[model samples]
Target: MKQLIVEIDETTEARIIIAAKTAGLSAQQWLKRIIDEKTVSSWPDSVKALAGSWQDVPFAEELRSGEGREKTY
Candidate 1:
């Protein structure tokens, strides 16, 4: 319910109009949807499952402590 004014190149403006028409949305609505998609962030279930998964991996603490890097350099 807020108003915004943005200046875009003619080519970009044309592309937005075409895409919005193709998607059956107004250009304003299309741009708002695009912004909403990009601005929201959430971790997926698969990634959340990875939490603490590394704890049981062999030598995880050694690797995290830079043991290999000290030996190589």
Candidate 2:
């Protein structure tokens, strides 16, 4: 695996350390988890589960089809 180097202020470092300790992880593990979350390639399960839940909402194609729109020109 490749390695990364970062520079953070002391206050930020202290905060990270404290959060890691609270979560029972080392600073590196906590940071890695955060990076993974931020860089995820797919929608989260909670968001995906919301699909088809709104029946009244128009799909993108329908909204852009210009139906019922008043022509100004």
Candidate 3:
């Protein structure tokens, strides 16, 4: 819900536009998703114990507990 002014390479911007359209999403939305993925959360491993039923185990958790979070189904 905020406006952002970012500079991208001309060719890269065009490629993002085409890829976003092919994926049935707007360019902004596609970029937001990518940004969200690369930005790691600061949540500690102990936080997982507080996250009830939360899946997708954090990388930190995998190392501490030696229990990877892979969907059984």
- Collision count for each candidate, in order: 0, 0, 0
TM-score of 2: 0.67
Whole-model lDDT values for every prediction: 0.87, 0.95, 0.82
Worst 10 residues of 1 by lDDT: 64-73
Better of 1 and 2 by TM-score: 2
Q: Write the per-residue lDDT of candidate 1 for residues 1-73, one digit (tens) a residue.
A: 7788898999999999999999999999999899987887987788899988886676756668865465644
Worst lDDT run of 10 residues, candidate 2, spans 62-71
The number of the candidate with the highest lDDT is 2
lDDT digits (tens) for residues 1-73 of candidate 2? 8888999999999999999999999999999999898999999999999999999998999888996789898
Better of 1 and 2 by lDDT: 2
RMSD of each: 4.4, 4.0, 11.8
Off by over 4 Å in 3: 42-73
Arrange candidates by TM-score, descending.
Answer: 2, 1, 3
Put the candidates in lDDT order, highest first.
2, 1, 3
Candidate 3 to native Cα RMSD, angstroms: 11.8
Tell me the lDDT of model 2 at 17.
100
Q: Give a tens-digit lDDT track for model 3, residues 2-69.
A: 89898889999999999999989999889988898689687767776686565665666566674555
Task: Estimate TM-scores for all models.
Answer: 0.58, 0.67, 0.51
lDDT of candidate 2 at residue 55, scale 0 to 100: 98
